[model samples]
Target chain A: MRSFDGVYEGFRAPVSSQKRSLPDSHNPAVNMASVRYISKVVKALLTFDNLIWYSSVKYVLRRCEEMKSGGAKALLSFVRVLVNIGWYAYLIVAVVTIIGIPHLLFRDYLPADKPMPWMEHQPGYTITFSDAVSAEGLASFARYGLVLGLPNLLIMLFILHNLRRLLAAGIENPFTLENARRMRIIGFLLLAGVAAEIGVNLITARFVINNVHIPGATIRANPLPYRGGLFSALLMLIVSEVFKLGVLLQEEHDLTV
Target chain B: MTIAVHLDRLLVERKMSLTELSERVGITIANLSILKTGKARAIRFSTLEAICRELDCQPGDLLEYVEDGEQPS
Candidate 1:
């Protein structure tokens, strides 16, 4: 039986050799083994390929880092960050001043009644000093100022912080994704604030008509006219939105390229 | 502004195609083109090694130092 087994093994070896030498035909088990081996080889090759790619990427990153730290590049980046921070600080001051000035001047005049027009053809309104001192009028002025000024101030601060980060990072271009994000946020806030202001004026007009009685009317009595202070504030807010849109466009262009 | 690269002239002298050299050196065609066109701001030693090996030349052959006001004839 052992001799018969050895003869069978020898026959099997020759048949396997013959099959390998043939052009097309192969055993199912042999084919499976070959497939496994090829797959293994491919995986090994892929590992090495990935290693090379990773090394190249690392090299490029290192080069960029080196450039970022270089003399003029580093100085420029610092300057840009400084300028951005300064600009935002200025904006904050401006917004605060604008909001604060009106309150400071008119704090005593709270809920100043809608002024009575003097001439039928003349288009001017006046707020008396007595009306500004009332409790409800003061509350109204404070609320208006806080609502309009706080958001603008906050937006400026947000932009300032992002710009500071970009500058410290030595980013080649300061206007990047970070600034774009902040601008979009500020834009939406500006729109909301403006809308809210419009709402407040509408509510204020209604309150004035129902609560206080005006004695004499000369010209048309629109509580809030086209050239009213609230109208100007809304226009300014709209302009800010436009500015944000411009900034967003510039950011998009940079990202696209 | 003062430094210049002479990779293109060297490649021309070696009578080797950029594609052939790229394949042999295991560098991308884009990088090789960048080097040849002198658009590359810097080169890595490993890349230099590969290029030297593929072209059968030294780094000196690929990179020539020309003085500030000197023009390559």
Candidate 2:
């Protein structure tokens, strides 16, 4: 039973005796100081780690000092030029759509048997006021949607394309304060355009519908909403004013930045 | 329209090889070859500095003016 166990036990006693013979000076102050030092070291390490993590996140989200060395400003200016081009193009489309409205509305007033001067031939058939009003309402809806949606969509696409190109070029300039402000202004303009259209439709719907009725013919106004051309034009003016204000605000912000 | 670089001549006079010079100057052999053959559009001041430092010569020593119909100067 006491084969090699007694010898191993004898060797363990010397190591335990040595440990026990060490000075047992248990000072609470010294222990607390050691604990405080360890805690301070841990806190410093944690702070350094946090700093690195935050800087890395900022580098990914926004263009840090290093990645802004390329032609970021030039690219943004080019994007602005593209936006202006798109705005002018949409303006041209809106003007053309507006010019066509009169012709579309007055097609029935032209001589039926004889071809009108502008018409290539008689408009296939005579269109009543009720039919004309319904068609005008649909056309107005289409034009309003186009005028409100196309320019903004084009600008957004341009921004997205440039953003992708910048990312591909390894240049990170996203989330800049200027860019965020510009985006907010664009959103405001789009929302204002929509609101203006809704307001005009609400106010002028009954007037345009009532005025288009045939005398003594007892034709009911097409139950559909209608906004007069002049009122729509006025709304467009208001939207344009909002757009101009937004542009001015954005430019002022850019200058200040 | 054409600017000739006399790097090859300088390298030969200094008893240096293209590979050795490229390695000492920290530039690719291909770029050094292009510089020597006068096919490069532009060279940076830093690269020029490194090359001059490694070759123990000035930039003018590595570049020479050759008139259109005249011999190299």
How far out, in Å, is residue A39 in model 2?
A: 46
Say which candidate scores most in TM-score.
Answer: 1
Fraction of true contacts retained by every candidate, in order, equals: 0.00, 0.00
Q: Count steric clashes of candidate 2.
A: 0
Expressed as tens digits, the lDDT of each residue in B1-73 for candidate 1 is 3446566776788887878888888877887777766666667788888877877788777777777688854
Off by over 4 Å in 1: A1-132, A146-257
User: Model 1, residue A45: what's the lDDT?
Assistant: 100
At residue B61, give the lDDT of candidate 2.
87
Compared with the true structure, what per-residue lDDT tens digits does model 1 show for residues A63-151? Answer: 56766778668556546756776876777787777777766554443223323222112225433333434444544555665555555
Residue B37 accuracy (lDDT) in model 2? 72
TM-score for all predictions?
A: 0.32, 0.31
Tell the DockQ for candidate 1.
Answer: 0.01
Over A142-161, each residue of candidate 2 has an lDDT whose tens digit, in order, gives: 44544544454444444444
- Report the Cα RMSD per candidate: 35.7, 32.3
Candidate 1's docking class is incorrect
Best by lDDT: 1
